[model samples]
Target: MNLIDFLFLVFATLAVGGGLLMIFSRHPVSAAMFMIISMVSVAGLFVLLESFFLAILQVLVYAGAVMVLFLFIIMLLDVGPEGSKSSKIKLLSGLAGVVCFGILMVFSLILVLNSYPECSSCAVWPTLDDNNLVLGQSLVFSTSVKSFGFGLFSKYMLPIQVAGFLLLAAMVGVIILSKKFVREGNPS
Candidate 1:
């Protein structure tokens, strides 16, 4: 109806479509590109929502950092469209994916069936003058950071520590995997 609503719909559609394409694309690099498109579209939606802090974070964190890391890994591994040389486990993997999708669909349907409150009923975030000032306020003014820390430390501490541990494990795993081949080439 309104201009903001129209822009929100457009950007939301673009984000979801791009995300689907990214997930289903055959080529890894193409998927990454689609993922970038999705991230940017989501950022646009954040802007439409007047969440400038989140919009910039989405672009900088997802598009700039995460997507670049994905691209770097893709390039480093040289994984092309035809790079999936293992067809041996295709059927098993496909069955697993279908099962997981079915479970998720059922859960999502159940969630939707439980009618929720109107979107307008949700508590709206304050519209800040500038994005950077908003971010600074959130990080320092205890508006967001205090509540965030409360949630993180109170209810989510274990999950946060688990995530940190997983990241550390991933780094170690990568090092171990690469070391195997590195040692094979150099006798030293």
Candidate 2:
């Protein structure tokens, strides 16, 4: 009805449509492009929701880093068009997917019907409100972020270090897997 509502609907439709295209596209590059489009649309939605931090994080983390990794794999692996082919077990996979989606939809519908919040006539984001200030303070100096930092340093430090090492190992593994190696018994 209103301009903001129209923009929200357009962004939402673009996000969902692009996500579906990403899921079903046969070409890896085309799927990646669709995924980027979806991520951008979702970022736009986050902006509409007045969550600027979340919007930036979504673009930086998902669109910039994760998508770079995905595209790198798609390109560096030299995966042909045939690489996107579905296996013979498609029917079973499709049935499982449909069942999972049905269950999820039922749960979501129940949640929406039973426990949905009442919409207030007040603007969603009032300017310079106490709640907004509190949210900002929490994000900047929260116990949660401090706890996360401590956990990184103490409890999960070794695992974090090992994860870095494992990533390095994976890079090595990828190189080894992609290389043409000759066995002792095989002709070069």
Number of the top candidate by lDDT? 2
Model 2: ten consecutive residues of lowest lDDT? 132-141
User: Please, what are the lDDT tens digits per residue for candidate 2 over residues 1-188?
Assistant: 99889999999999999999989888889999999999999999988876666688899999999999999999998776655336657877888999999999999999988895666986645544322213422432222334446546766689999999999999999899989888998786
The 0-to-1 C-alpha lDDT of every candidate, in the order given, reads 0.79, 0.80
> Over the stretch 124-167, how does candidate 1's per-residue lDDT look in tens digits?
55433322322433432232334555656766789999999999
Which residue pairs of candidate 1 clash? Answer: none
What TM-score does each of the candidates earn?
0.59, 0.65
Candidate 2 error regions (>4 Å): 83-88, 117-132, 135-188
For residue 16, give model 2's deviation from the true position in Å: 0.9
